[model samples]
Target: MTELVPTPNNCVLPRIRADFATFNDAIDYAAKSEKGMNFHDMRGTLTRVYPYSEMRADAVQMAYRLVDAGIGKADRVALIAETGPDFAALFCACTLAGAWPVPLPLPTTFGGKDSYIDQLSVQLQSADPKVLIYPPEIAEMAAAAAERQGCEGVDWDTFAQRPAPEVELPKADPEDICYLQYSSGSTRFPQGVAVTHAALLHNLYGHAASMDIGNNDRVVSWLPWYHDMGLVGCFLSLIANQVSADYLKTEHFARRPLAWLDLISRNEGTTLSYSPTFGYDICARRISSQSNVEERFDLSRWRTAGNGADMIRPDVMQNFVNAFSAAGFKASAFTPSYGLAEATLAVTVMPPGEGISVELVEEERLSGTRRDLSRPARYRAIVNCGKPLPDMDVEIRGENGEVKSHHQIGKVWCRGPSVMHSYFRNQEATDECLVPSEDGKGAWLDTGDMGYVDAKGYLFIVGRAKDMIIINGKNHWPQDIEWAVEQLPGFNHGDIAAFAVETENGEEAPAVLVHCRVSDPDERVKLRDEIRDKVRAITGMNCVVELVPPRTLPRTSSGKLSRAKAKKLYLSGEIEPFRLAA
Candidate 1:
């Protein structure tokens, strides 16, 4: 075997070396490369498809207008528009002006006008942006919220008219904060993860290197920009690499899953992307509905179908591959990855040209000794999240702070240039998350995820350490139990929460609670029985299934179910208990 070589400096710059001087040089290079590249969406689509010159001029003009609107260095500007050319331009403007852009998701409230107003109000207050830029439809909503908070609300039309300002770009330090990314808030209060320009640049270079992204690659993605994966993985990486890309609206993709594939096939896109579970389920559902999907388009150009953001399902991947094999979609295109918002975006990416690999381990053994990764009669598959990126190191340490041997589940810790500077405005939380070990040589960012590395040096994430439940000296992952219960027919699709609750003696046991839309009482009972039987059959542990009314399940601002909040409601009996499976 050949020895691994260091990446060439001309290929990518390190964070320390990527100062304002080098960053400007990179921007110049990108500008020169962007001549024929389209920046925005196509005609009739909500996307903007401008060439490099147009994108640069628009961004520069937007930067001037933003400064005139009192959004300068270090000021926060909240963007409430859907994904489009204007959103990208405004974001680039923020970066140019050294402003932090906080992108909030559009409010989703099926209740009524008041419900929508309330939700929007809460986000506006939380964001507290200096200026709120939104589309015409939500201009009034944004104006009212901004008025209530004493912030300025600028409609896109008025905001677009300002002439490009001639402000000198500041020399950005390596530690200068770039943007604030909020968590999904699925567990608790959403804290903004403060990423720096240096960290972002570093991570993007690593991402491009791992995915083999270049100026020639055309990326088409529909993931939400508010999320790190969409923002950094798709948008910023494209801009930094001077690559052309097409972005579809997240809503559009959700409504029509085939549009995602259609866009890729139509564009002959080399970089196919999405969160792992999403791409898998989307392909699965599409294949089930249409039989001739494989014959319709040529997916042979798809080089990298990236999978990240959530737990990777081996069955889902295999099913998708088998379903689309006739369509010229190579199984080798599936790239399982691991990353977090705290790491800017990517920490580890599976080796290039290599597809996903899974290790089938005994579930019981995992909970017991955390020893050998023995193949089980009923196995739990662990997909490789790949190796750490260049200049990054990953280690799994036990509670005692010592590095664990291969196959021992421990807290995943990362040390790299791409790690965020700190959590925004929360030093205490920062200290806790970014800490030094007992030996105190170097610092490591606590990923709070639990996983182990195999003998082949591949990382296999099992679950989150903080999400584990200790019941009767046994450790149980909510995902394990939740996956088992979710396999049931009624509980398979909707909002579900599985957590551990303590008895009067303080001993905890797995308590499964499911929230479904089914209204009929007899049907509810059958649903509960199905969930219980399936969970019991999968895992030997007997779980209690409680059925609640539709929409009772607490979701975060980003629409993820909050198991922590659900557990609180369950313990306090604040939730209305409907019927349970007999």
Candidate 2:
């Protein structure tokens, strides 16, 4: 395997347009250039080098074939989103065919066959796809899921063999629905976020313009295609801006994360990349086990190292920078931002070259508890997720639906053209969160996240509103508690889940579920006591700490620990507690 896959001569950057009416229109112009996408493996080997011209041609053929297969405009085409050439081709084909492509999650590491099948069945039922498509590797599970949904399942090889229709292809309009993106569903069942071409284009334009994206910018990513950030930010953004991108599958990154950096090191062009806090932490830890860190990679050209899809941790970012600085990695390249599936992808992006900036807020101010002026003050570091994109509005809403001031934490609400049209087929869910704005120009999406903006307009997230633990009248973010426990030895991220449970007296008390790897009864009991002490020290509340076997905690498709599901399983007695036999 070659260390570097040389960029094609024709992949030279082009003059980016201000905006496009639709993604198809964007791709149509991008195809005029040679810039395209490259997919790599865990060994940093380039498996496929797909240019825009070939992709456009292949997509056109696939679009006509789908038409011949009896698919019509606005019909749902369910795609098992894996990072590869087939999924990309089929996604573009659906756009050109004027059909709504619903990108569904691939099987996760946590879920077994049955769990995956159930998840697939739920999404297929909601999407009501005309046809289901998947890679051959998971043909059995995909076929079973399609059978449950009563839809025809076709693998990539079979789908490619179909003949194209001998007729003019349908074109997609700006107002037409582009695709359905199911949210990460960390706290609840996944709902399909209906994104239109106009909304998607608007967000893409904002993303490019906000970052001042130029011809020199190149993207490298391992984010999953099913998620909004990976699909819109990495895949579609490159097409719309006529920039080249390199990709490693999410699973590959999990096994050999250094390969991602190695790929970047070999590429000379200006690099732009993004990941959650965990991504950075794991890579830094892996570096400790290997030698020759400085000579193996060159990250000086990586200008924009974005952090999103989860809370941005300053300590983790600092560790990564320190570990890789010898190899020319800059701490100033970190761009912490915030967004969700509903906003299409990005709501706020830190300007290029600004790095990661954060503010220190008093603990009482952050937790909504009264501070005793006589006591010594303590502060928590909240990373600043830069200003909102041009024309987007963000506000902090209090419990009464009134907006809050700066430094005041509340539910984060946003209004912008880039927001989704609605939650498909779920009016109740849509109405529960989406509300009209005062100006009546557009509606505000209740992000269901709690955060506040500083005077400089940078957003700072606290935690999920629903996940905030309330004991008496004070609020405590679960992540803060979880992070505190994670600081202990022999623990890692996603190993702890915290929530509020009602006591026998009907008062809310914090309960913690820790994934215990200790076997000895004495050590297990000691670990439990340590966790309780940690929680009590932080929040001043006695928390019930229960230990469970490792890997027993539930997780979302994107590998995020699902606190809601954990709580449900614990309440129902499905998650058995770890006990030492006397």
* Highest lDDT against the true fold, candidate: 2
Clashes of each: 5, 0
In order of appearance, the predictions have TM-scores of 0.75, 0.81
Off by over 4 Å in 1: 1-28, 35-47, 109-127, 163-165, 185-188, 369-377, 437-442, 468-582
Q: Candidate 1 lDDT, tens digit per residue, 1-582?
A: 453221111223222212233233444455554322232233214233455456666777888888777677788887874777677777777777778887765553222444344445555565567987887777766777777767888877788976765777655565677777764322123356888777888887887777766444567777777777888787777667666666667667666766677667766444556554655677676777677876675778887888887777777777787777777778888888888888988888887668889888776555543444474344678889998888788989887678999998888999887898887677887898797655664569988888999887789998744665544212345665676566566555445787766456433456777877788778878777777776554334566778777788788899877887787777668897785545
lDDT of 2 by residue, 1-582 (tens): 555443553444455643888989987988888788888888878878898878899899999999999998889999999998899999999999898998887876653676578768878888889999999999999999999999999998899998886678777788889999875332124578999999998998898887777777788899888877788888888888788888899989988988889988987784788887778888898997777888898998888898887667788899898899999999989988888878998999898889888788887786666889899998878888899998899999997899999878999999999899999999998998899888898999998888998888888887755676645323456776788799899999999999987678544578999999988999988888888887776566688888999999999999999998898789869999887442
Clashing pairs in 1: 40-48, 40-49, 41-47, 41-48, 41-49
**C-alpha lDDT score of every prediction, in listed order:** 0.68, 0.84
Deviation (Å) of 133 in candidate 1: 1.4
For candidate 1, the clash count comes to: 5
Give the worst 10-residue stretch by lDDT in candidate 2. 182-191
What TM-score does prediction 2 earn? 0.81
